[model samples]
Target: MKFCYKNGILDWRIVVLVFLLYLLHALTVKILVVASIIAICESGILLFLALKRRLDLYLYTLVIILATTFEFPMFVDESLKFVPSIIMLPLISGYFFLLLSLWPLPKMLGNGSIWKTISKKFPFLFSFVSITLVLGIVMGVLSLFTDSTSKTFHFSFFVKDLMILGVFNVYALYFMYSSLIYPQFKQKLELIIFSVLVAMILAALFVSLVGAKGFYGTNEIMLMPLSFFFSTTIVFFLFYKKYSNNHFVLLIFLSCITFFMQFAYSNALGGKSWLVFFLILMTCLIFWYKRAKLKLILGSIVVFLLFPFLLNIVEKKTDGDSLSSSKLVQALSLVSVVDVDWYTNLPLSPKIRIEELLNTNLEFVKHPSFALFGKGFGGGHQDYRYAYGGYNPAAFSLEEYNNEYFIRMHESVNTIFLKFGLLGLVLSGTLLFRHCLVCNKSPWLVLGCLWFVFFWGYSSSLMSIGLSSLFIGIEDVRDK
Candidate 1:
């Protein structure tokens, strides 16, 4: 993969430069507009060169960089106004990337004949991209008729899921082409990964000291520094697990403990005790599988049983609620397929969090049309603030409500229902279960890394996008 810079100037430097400008945007408040201007200009030039060469990779990178950097942090006013145009660029770019990357496959698999595709060796990759893209487009068009506070948000997220799908395909295609065809491209991945890790550490530190008071605030900052270390640990565990690497194991242990301590004691995201437990259990399971020792299994079971006790101690010291009193069980209880009317008239409990899910789902299936098409992206939650008491747009703000209720639909499965109705639910649900149901090396590793991502999606939309990309990149190959 020796990049011919003399003939066609696309290389690692372009990727690094764009990411640096994005970091600058995230760090300095005043540099947002200026950084975007420079990055977008560079992207335009790259896109022009890519078109001349007919290389879709450059266009793919262009769209992802745009989408990744333009994190619409806040909404301006009654209307999103200029915000919609800015955000839409990424979605539109992402759609083109999808088409460029995987087109005729959709045409062949358009009918109910997708089972043939799912039966392949690498079914996870093919099934996820095909199903999500087809269903997402159908639901996006259908959702346009539904009322929403902002059309920009509605349109952008309508196709937002495609961005992740596109990323997966583009990345896989890049690695395949580089490995089999060019071979030199493999070296470039290491450079990109190393640069990203270094930049994330520096940016995380800078943001903690100076940028905490902004929109992301203190709680996010507490977890910021762990990104680089955690990412590096996962990379090494996946790639270098065959060799003797006690240091990697130590790093993983420290990362888990540090992540738990920071989030637990800081009174940040404390209500998500279920998620914390699930993560701890998954981590233990991964390490235990890697070692396959009886002591590890017994020790994991002990810790699993005592997790609530540990949470109790942590909560008492921090003046937070105990995990035993959490609504996790109640939320899980609503997973059955009951009548809509039954869920609607159910009495509210200590919190209306689960009730909100029931009511929204009822609203979704109340009518045949609504049940078929759904209210679109950014729809289904206009009056959610009333049910949850009040909405707090800021993280860790004084306004005391489950801020997650603002975007999350209690369950990602149900969220799919609210977005694209029964059809969408079936498609996404199939992708979720069938892809990773078999516990192979690649699939298992992806599950370990992203179990919490999918689980948390049931409670919030946090990892629904960013971390989901990791699942697609994992392979059974050791070198990857």
Candidate 2:
């Protein structure tokens, strides 16, 4: 197959045709017409790319398969209503596109010394396995006692989810280890970027379909992992690539756009704490500007900080307080409150919250009698009632707060700790710390990775599929 980009091979005419076809399909209400057009477009792209021997095309196909596989199971259960497969389908597609762009690979130059050093440290793999085994034993024991049908198990769902989560935890560890030791930055970045774009497109489509529901309600949370991947990739790109003044300006503009988009979505859909998200981004920008004094960074920060305040003032003057209670404004207010609360109650020491969170997870710890090595996959209770009292704890509940702290406490912090315990937490933390260390050697990369890590902590579990791709991508960039 020809790998060359021949002249006229990708003409503007073909592009326009594809766009028109897509536009028409989107405008039409006929279900069959839309489906047929989508299938044709997707298939045509695949066929064209394949005929041209563009293996890069496989990235999209892989996303479709992976996203469908991951989400299809949810639809199978008749009891589970409100499945948003439409949103997931496009998200998966966008993720694949992003992955294609950010995969990393080490420079194939004089790097024998680095390879030798990696070879010497190879024994860490065994150490990681041993640690995982110990944690597995602990989890097995906890599962037995907590999951004994006779016992009044409040968190039995933890045990069931643990088995699935445990496997992924191990996979995540191995991925990190491979990333660190092998250091295939180029390949990983490409994969990560590809996955992120696919995820983003899907997320946008999903949110649109769900009439702009909150993050969790529209299953927008799934996109967080993908967002981490792309944001980090962009940061890495800016750090490594030689940039002109124009490029730097563009970067600032893009960041501003992203900040506003997230804010708008948070307001329109009651999913995330918009204020917290904005504050985090603002804080990062402020620190970046203060430390570097780069005009682009400084300008972006100033604009972002002042934009909301100015908007608020204008709204109050024009619309009055009652009329100014727009969804976006309300979301922004919520975010502000949550961010203030988090910092105000910040833990005094390192690992303090994680440690405390682990203790709560001890309720799920079982005895060795249940299984010394560990309960095999899917060994815990399958009942949703056992998990969160028949309530989707991750979902918004009027009974509790909708801030990041509560979300962390319920969805990510407690979930991982309960299932994988200390080992998982340590390994996950180590992987992130390593990524930070690698990227930190360069300021631009460091800033990018930091942005991703912050969002990852706030929105999703470290072991999640999207987060995994993110780490892999960052690791890839570092290798390069």
Candidate 3:
């Protein structure tokens, strides 16, 4: 059967007929019910394709498996939101596939040719400063013309969009410059060292003199530098040559250690669990690191041992009570669903949640008519809230859902799905899959792709202003 398909001896009509039968049933049945049948079929197809040397089809099959895994868990309980997982898994998978399809096979995958092509057309340094200055001026003028509180001009929204666009452009330019102009290992090394030093100094200053009041109370300008620094460091270390290997490993390790120490001290002194999450992620990455053998094993072991302790520390720090201890006991007691009425009573984080709702609602409203074709270039509303939070004003409310796990909730996932629909989902998924495919052959590109994938979920609209800047920056770097 596989041989017949590979050789084109089997009639294509037969395959189409089979697919139609399955798809018809899929649409008619409950999604989970249909998905189970499709999953089995897809698995068989994947196995067949793998044996037949149909690499592309095999990969697509792998994507289907991954997508299904992510989606299926959500369907087990309607109350347990699964839409986000379903939407994201396929979207990312399709993206990776699309990216792979665009590139020349295997060897040329991460050669930086794509970046070079764009950079050759536009000079990096001139483009960077010029774009930044223009955006900054436009934003400044717009800010002056409209009242921040006024609904008419929506100055806050416009300014936010401009800022997002500016940041995206800046990131793109930086990556381009780094890849193309910073040719030597020494240049990359120097840049990383400088960035880390600057970030450390700023962090120390913020921690010591500025204090929490100053840190959170300000207009977030100080925070911007730190965020930029950390994000850049993440990008740089992921792609940089000298520090890309064992040095990067050491840096991550030390960083995790530092975070753990901070968590410990915070528990003793009263701090936050947000930092603990960051630390856990860092620790997890150490094990996920592809190169170092011993570090991965050791890191895994350490994480396992420290897991309970870390939970206790986090719980204590977060609620300022024995809540963590009780939760631990409940978890150990195999209490599957622990009811907490306090959740329903608690108010939502208005600032963040409201913005998120607005962005999602906007996308949902715009989606029906504009389903096939996306809002063409700068056609999207330039609301600051949407730019930052991916919220749609049309769909959600300021009223808190009270679920701390809203990140994985259906509401959150459905927002993007509503924006893009099936077509958008496929396109986005293809792009991500393609990225993975290309990067698989090119280690450097793999690192870059990983960085992008990791953050894609945390932000709104993967293909918007941010990606534009990122792609352009990467292109610039590759060309020089």
Top lDDT: which candidate number? 1
Cα displacement (angstroms), candidate 2, residue 165, comes to 1.7
Between prediction 1 and prediction 2, the one with superior TM-score is 1
Clashes by residue pair, model 1: 1-184, 1-185
lDDT of 1 by residue, 165-190 (tens): 33443443333332333334334333
Query: In model 3, where do residues sit more than 4 Å from their true spots?
Result: 1-116, 119-151, 154-156, 170-194, 197-213, 217-224, 228-241, 244-313, 320-367, 372-432, 436-480
TM-score, model 2 to reference: 0.49
Q: List ranges where model 1 is wrong by over 4 Å.
A: 1-23, 49-128, 139-281, 285-299, 320-356, 369-386, 394-411, 438-440, 443-480
Q: Count backbone clashes in candidate 3.
A: 41
RMSD of each: 8.8, 10.6, 23.3
Ranking by lDDT: 1, 2, 3
lDDT per residue (tens digit) for residues 1-480 in model 3: 121231211223333433343233223223544544554465456556645754433432332233113232211222322222222222342233223222223422355665565446444333433333353444335333432233333333333433333333443443343344333422322222233323333333333333321112111112111112122233333344544453566456545543443322222111112323433456446546755666676767786566556555645565624332333332322222243643332223323334454554564464444434322211232233423333432222122122111212122223223223344345445545655554323333433343343333223222222233334333424444
| Model 2, position 466: C-alpha lDDT score | 49
Give the C-alpha miss distance for residue 27 in model 1, angstroms: 3.0
Which structure is stronger by lDDT: 1 or 2? 1
